[model samples]
Target: MSETILPELPQELWRAGKLELAHGVQQFLQVMRVASAGLGQYLAEIESRGVKDLYGYGTTISWFADIAGLSMGEARPYVNRAIDLNPTRALDGTEIPPFAPATGAAAAEGAIGAERIKQILEILRQIPAEVSVEDREHAEAKLAGLARDAGPRQVSDLGEQVLGWLDPDGKEPKDPEPAQPRRELTLQRRKDGYWNLKGLLDDEAGARTAAALEAYAKPRPVDEFGQADLRTKAERQGDAWVDLVDLAIACPDQPGTNGYRTLVHVTIGLEELKTGLGTACLDFVGTMTAREARLAACDCLMLPVVLNAAGEPLDVGRLRRFVTPGQRRALNIRDRGCTFPGCHRRPKNCHAHHIHHWADGGPTDLRNLTLLCSFHHRLIHHGDWQVRMAADGLPEFIPPQYLDPLQRTRRNTLI
Candidate 1:
């Protein structure tokens, strides 16, 4: 029982990072990737058979989380993946089913759990291979309701729908142009308290950016319990998100920021502070990163740009001169990370967004400055969404017409 230590490497490692450090990081990443894949498979197993045999079965996700060394929310996905990767029984109701090979169904549904896998597989088999993830996901969701009562008739109907999806004669290959490329995000709030966000990003840029933000907003590990005499939905989802975040950060591809819990989120009221306007902080849902909150709090959450009426572009908020060391310390308590609608990013992943920028005649007080993770900040700067202060001084989000034809503006109290 002796301690294990690596032989010392030569000093004067490159300024970027030591070669040994780089190698070690790479090795760790490889291990993590392999582990994540295996974990997905295991979660497939758990979803079918309740965690009853597992130590934390009928209780809180916290117990399982302890074993994974992840937050309760984070652990849930592993459990779900275990469930989703391979359902307890395959379509024949005999041996558990596995996704059709190479369809990538295992990876996606696994994150949600076996139940979702079943739906995904059903939808995938029905649709042609060419269908997009978004379309497939939507179809799966619609069909999910029949899982309990699925019979031969339903199965046959699904097969027909899939055939139609495959051919879709006379239609262009289902590739919708990538979402609009975002260049900047400018949000404007009216005196009525509604805000609008608009911006731009090219395909690769927008996707990568979206991926980065989603890396944090995934649901936590709370999926095990359910409405049928299980834990509350909030608790289950929260755990899934927590677990997902931990897993994402530990992975090789993540931004590798930290201190997610410490950042401060401020919701400025445009009405209270402005002329009868409102303010709101960012929203953390689906994906969130704890690491992003630690290292670059200022850059992580607060968005620096704004827009005016007539869809004009303006750069009002700037975190550079505004975030004092002491103020940053206060900010940690104020903003956990990017303060965008339906986004969950840590401070390190966010930027110190200002309701008003000092450069644009904005005040440095908490009344104006807030947090927004990089993506949301950009969403604030470029996307067709909106953010503004509420009566209570909180951030709100309004989806673009494409996401919701109704184009409703929404708000959240949590940053």
Candidate 2:
């Protein structure tokens, strides 16, 4: 590659008027679109040169994902587009043409965007296999031309009409054996410590899974303070899945491991466990913040193994912070639900939070304890919000100064 000179950005953008700003936006978008087309060309060349031979990677998609700091799911589309819109060379050094050369030309000129390019390629792929090569080329040309002045939806509508014209009568129906139900699931961990879950389920299993998740995914009703649930549909569904997993784990009939119930172990140094100021290792998965470990330890969700400076387990007395079954029952009766003001989450979905954090020399007794749902628990721990047990023996929240200048104490009235 050679060094290339480019135009400088116009100065004092804040001084630009509305029309100038709009014109600048249009020009920059066209530049970006053309640059993206160039990137696709480079990607195709890399694929042709053999990503494994050049970069020592198993696949082009994984290599790009690593280089760009993106998940494989996010990088696959770019690789797929590059292969479709750029020509490739066969093993024998024979030059093969692009699947959608016309669309590629339009994209290179920045006349169409990613969405229209995708639409045009899909339209070309749907052309009848028996159609003459000349007819297929004509169809691609027409779709690319339609795409220059229209959005993806308009291009797709025209594509449907073109397909109908090519095959006025659809393929003849032939009787075949009834298909068997099939399902496959893939769970992979990403570099960011998050897991990606992708799956395919047959109709019956899909319907049942949808019904179960939907039952728990309903939006929380507006509480007494009129603050409605702000979680998006996808967020609600993700939380619902967590709820289902917890329910399954809580079942007594679940299989055990080595004569003990399947348990998650959190390993933390004594100082980190006491001060909540460092990281802790989680069993099977990865690490979590000491603050998160402290919170989980309060409810005994994960058995905490306190270690000394030499990295040996210490006798930290696990029962000291563990809330007994009777204590939990008493807590359920006392709080009825999350103690955070305006929250309507039930006891079953709440965690036992130590108002004066147990890690800070606070006793694990009723007076120092409160029930908080996961959202509010994180808010209390990570945000400016504060919770304390009032003189009346019930939990009360003190609003942060920014939320209320006077920092008024509020109590949940729904209980």
Candidate 3:
């Protein structure tokens, strides 16, 4: 193949008119498309020769990710695109054609962009296996030709039309037996300190879950401050899930292991728990911030196993931190709901937070305890907010200096 030199940027680019700038951008995009196609050819050759042989990496995508300073997920698409658009060699030295030769050709000419190419390739892949080879090729060619002038969405719409014309009826299931229900769930933690939850449930299970979540996910009533829940539907659902987990843990009938109620156990240093400045180990899971551990420990939502410098269990304080039922009822009667100003969270949705933490020798009585919703509970722990009992035997919050320079104390009048 002959080398093609790319054009240099126009001199005094800052002085270019609007139309000229638009024309320049179009020209540069065409150059990029051509270059992308050329890169795919090189990548195909590398794969054919064996990436392990050349770079000592197990996979071309992995090596590319490392060399290009990209995440594995970001690098995968480029490598996949290359393999799908370029010819490869079989182990027996036979030539294996690209999956969509017509699309690849259009991509090479810079007549289509990457998104359009992806749409065309996906359309080609969806063609029924039982369809004739000639029909598949014709469909692929038509999609690619349309992609040259149309957007990806238009190309996709045309492709779907072609598919409907070719097959008319969808593929029939091979098995005569009725399909079985499928239910699956996956929860994974990433290095960036976030958890990904994905799941699929059968119809019966799905309906039950939707009902449960919807019950708790309803928007909060307008508060004294005129603010509604303000959380999006998705955020409300997430909070509802947390509430459901809290309820399950608080249930007496919930299953247990090793003679203890099913609950998250956090192993934290005594200093970390006190100062909220280090990390803590979440039993059987991973790690959490010391501040979070402090918050989790305040209410024993996660039972804390406090450690000394020698890594010995200095204090478990599981039973000692627990507020008695009598005390909880009194707390609910007095405080009613979340003590945070304007919060409307009810007793069931709130955690009994120790004003002076139980770990710090604070009593578990009503005066020392207050009800706080999960959001306010986290805010009180992580943000500059403060909460305390008043002279009138009620819980009140003090806004940070920024919110109120005088730092005036406020009560939940809404309750």
Candidate 4:
């Protein structure tokens, strides 16, 4: 190869007029196109002579990266261009044609750059293999002519139009294969005492799970204390999953429950059960705070095994702490839905919450119970809201001190 000299820029070019500066930029781009074509040809020569083996590199790209200080990503396009534009010699010494001869010629003369050549190659490659050699050559020549006057983006759009004209119906569609069964679940305990759940489900099971979660994941209403449901979408979905578990445990037809609706057993000391400040064993797998045990025990979703200080089982309370079905039907009919001031839940979604807790000797009758959804039920237990039965045998809510200094009573009329 002969060494080429670069032309010196005029000293006044820095302060040149707008037209002069624009013309200088166009000349620089033309020089860059010629350099790019030379680089591609050199790469082709290096590959033909197996120069990569002398350098102890596996491929031409690795060798180019080390020699030119370019990353593999930057060197790959040059190598690809070389493979498309350079002719090869067969074993018998006959010359084989390059993939894109017209593009190669234009690039060598500084008439087009790598991007334009790449766009032309992409369009030509998309021609169906079933297409004849004559038809493919015709399409390639037409695209290369368009490239001379149009940008890569315009050329790409024109290629799509040409392909549509060539094959109006597009490629033939194949029949879909049968779906395989797929269902998996992983429940692993973490060091922090929380269970990590992961799973995959088939289409039918996924759709059913999504529908179930969405049915219970509706946004919660603002409470009597003027506090809105600020939980995020993921948080609401998690709460919905808990509600679904509760529903499944309460189902009468589920197998392996031994005619008992509860799924697990929670054992706690009598002092802990009363004070709600200690730890309790949960199904021999982990421990939960006594307060959570109390809440779980409230609905009797898990059977509670009360132990005295001596670690012997003791009768904590009546076996029937949960409201009876007959009593629940009466409560549902009376409250209609959640009795929170702005809640809109239906009767089926409501729980029979105790005005006075059953553990505190409150009766499981109509006068001591009102229906509340899961969110409002927790709010009543944890937030600064209050609930009571009025003289008309209906439930009403009272605002917290921060929200209503006067603490006026309110009722939900939306339900």
Instruction: Identify the leading candidate in terms of lDDT.
Output: 3
Prediction 1 TM-score vs. true: 0.25
lDDT of 3 by residue, 221-288 (tens): 77544656789999999999998887676665656622122356788888887788899888747888
Clashing pairs in 2: none
The alpha-carbon deviation from the true structure for residue 184 of candidate 2, after best TM-score superposition, in angstroms, is: 3.5
Question: Pairing residues by index, what is the TM-score of model 3?
Answer: 0.56
Candidate 2 residue-wise lDDT, 196-300, digit = tens:
999999999999999999998999777644668899999999988876765565454656532211256888898998787999988847998898877676665
* Candidate 1 lDDT: 0.49
Better of 1 and 3 by TM-score: 3
Clashing pairs in 3: none
- Each model's lDDT comes to 0.49, 0.81, 0.82, 0.78
* Number of the top-ranking candidate, with TM-score as the measure: 4
Q: What are the per-model C-alpha RMSD values against the true structure?
A: 25.0, 10.2, 8.6, 8.5
Cα error, residue 303 of model 2, in Å, equals 2.9
Return the TM-score for each candidate structure.
0.25, 0.52, 0.56, 0.62
The C-alpha stretches of model 2 lying farther than 4 A from their native spots are 1-181, 218-231, 257-262, 316-320
lDDT of 3 at 332: 78
- Candidate 4, after superposition: displacement of residue 310 in Å? 2.4
